[model samples]
Target: MRTEEYAMHDHRRLGRELGLFDTDPLMGAGLPYWLPDGAVVRHVLEEYVRDAERAAGYRHVYSPVLGKRELYEISGHWAHYSEDMFPPMRLGGEEVVLRPSLCPHHALIYRSRSRSYRELPLRMAELGCMYRSEPSGVLGGLTRVRAIQLNDAHVFCTLEQAVGEARAALALIRRAYVDLGIRAARFRLSLPGEGGKYVADPELWSRATALLREALDGIAYEEAAGEAAFYGPKIDVQIADPAGRESTLSTVQIDFHQPERFGLGYIGADGARHRPVMVHRSVVGSVERAVAHLVEQHGGAFPVWLAPVQLLVLPVGEAQEEDAHDVVRRALALGLRAEVADPGQGTLGARVRAARLVPYVAVLGEREAGAGLAAVRLRDGRRPGAVPVEELLGRIGGVARARGAELWEAS
Candidate 1:
């Protein structure tokens, strides 16, 4: 598609057209309310990431969006990141602020209990909420919203294990991108640059930078000074939009600062205290931006497993309503997301076209309904001949369960 026309497929427009999300003046800029469809997509994405984390031995945690002002002071966010953070709010006697990051809370979780060297790699994950004080001009759809739901995780491990953990995190990111249809435009070794609010620890910075390089050992990446997080160096996975504008969608960072500031320590094998290194990584950084990118990447035609409406059932006429609904029920019972479009809504052809982005469209007519079959039409315009309802549901269910990128499950 031409660039001008491709702009129409931008997530902002698709959000409105596809009932994904929207912004209201009364609600203010930089905040968008996700519509029902958008919420479904978000929920699915969160669940997928959570499951992935769990399978990788990461324990999930929940942290409040607001933290005591003292928390940020200790984490160094107040000193270096206050410009981008929302101002503190007074609650009774204590001052609290909307957290700009989840690292501080995760750090506290780690400190909550005494740790031993046996749990050296304590992986903690959360689909947490955070906010930014973005200017209106910089705020756009889900891409640049002030309210962010991040798929964030932190790995607290021994210095010897930090590089290996970082590499594992990067591998997980690559796997996620392949399934989500995201193409990384580049991999960046983000380092602190001149004039940046970087932690003034030269030795720590040098060591962390070297560790990240080891994590990205064989991967080709350009070293970009000044692009690193305030605390440490990172490997940033970059993706571009249809218009060729690029942004970071995933990251893996090695940090030696937070543990020191938070006084985090674990009992060593020799029965002495040792500071554990912290590694921060996000397979898909912000859920909002990730979905926005996916919207544009597939033009709202998400992979079967990620589609808000996996299957749309259309009845050829009122006489087929019962059969159409039956098909929907069977699909739903098989753990598929299915919906039925009444014959009264529109013509069969019109209904199918209306749901062109849906992964599967099952048309039930009197003839097919009598034979207990459905004529399946795929989003990419393939009409898989009529098959028994049970068989069709089973195939789609298998694909969704496998999180298959293609409409058909691989043999």
Candidate 2:
């Protein structure tokens, strides 16, 4: 057997080879079409994050991808961020634009009703699809795309709650990275400095930055000048790929300007209306980028729980075809993503080679079929002898349910 590595670790190439996703010239650049295999991985990740957010007291909501131009204007995106946003479209005498961020919409939700101090720290979450007018030259694979689905959330809380909320956001980021086996090389406290891009409020910026610092007291992070958004100071979670290239995958921002601009307020215990602070957080900044990162991080060999095709069943010959079908049925019944390879498609060795990237492979032969067993082959070069169909089901199901990063041992 020959073992080698590609000179260029491009996700575009890996995505094609794995049948994950693709882009078309006719469809336009930076717009990726998620193939079935790719969609499965995305679905798993989305569900995982959704459950995590729910447990963290975030109430999920669905918001439109387009909003009135004035919404962004009120949120300060129109004056400061219009260049990166798509040009506004006029419809029925009203100008609308594809939302570049979910912050404004979330602020609207918070202001839809009269909130009180008792309901402070209202966490709103959404897997929001957003669009940006990215330059064609910079568009590359899933990492940099014109359209993105962000794992985004915003918290409207009192000043006293902002610090705790920021710390909780950091904890969520750490837990997510740990679960996905991603290592953040460093954290960066991005502050506004000598830039017209930031809101001109020294006191707000100082207070916001200090709150972030207090929340991150024991955590290590470096200060980055002028890296913040126009509306806020943020903490960026930076990670490095195998090639030593680094990118920010997660962020927690403290926004003091948006609430004031939108007039977002809640009744305080002192019987007065006070502006609430907004905390913007994303566990995985972009689902597409996260997939690209994982593809490279694992060299396209995804863990069983996240693998597009967790198991592939191969029939040794025509006589075992029924057995292979049965295996697939059993696997599917247990919620395992499994399929049977065409017996006539290729030789057993060729078929096995074709499925090497899959996490698990089950070879069904005359002996195995008669005994109601399967010869299991693991991607890690483990060839476990024939095992009962029921046992194999339990093993695969257990690992998937547990979100285990490795295959279960066949004893």
| Backbone clashes in model 1, listed as residue pairs | 193-226
Q: Model 2 — TM-score against the truth?
A: 0.97
Give candidate 2 regions above 4 Å deviation.
1-8
Q: List the residue pairs that clash in candidate 2.
A: none
- The Cα local distance difference test for each model comes to 0.92, 0.90
lDDT of model 1, residue 282: 99
Error of 1 at 21 (Å): 0.8
TM-score of each candidate?
Answer: 0.98, 0.97
lDDT of 2 by residue, 1-411 (tens): 112343245677889888899988999998989999999999999998999999999999999999999999888888989999999999999999999999999988899999999998899999989999999999998999999999999999999999999999999999988788788989999988785887888898899999999989999999999888887799999987676778889999998999999899999999999999999999989999999999988878887888899889999999998889988988888889999999898899999999988988999999999999989998888887788989888898888777787686636
Cα lDDT of model 1 by residue, 346-394, tens digit: 7778888899999989888888999999988999898887888888888
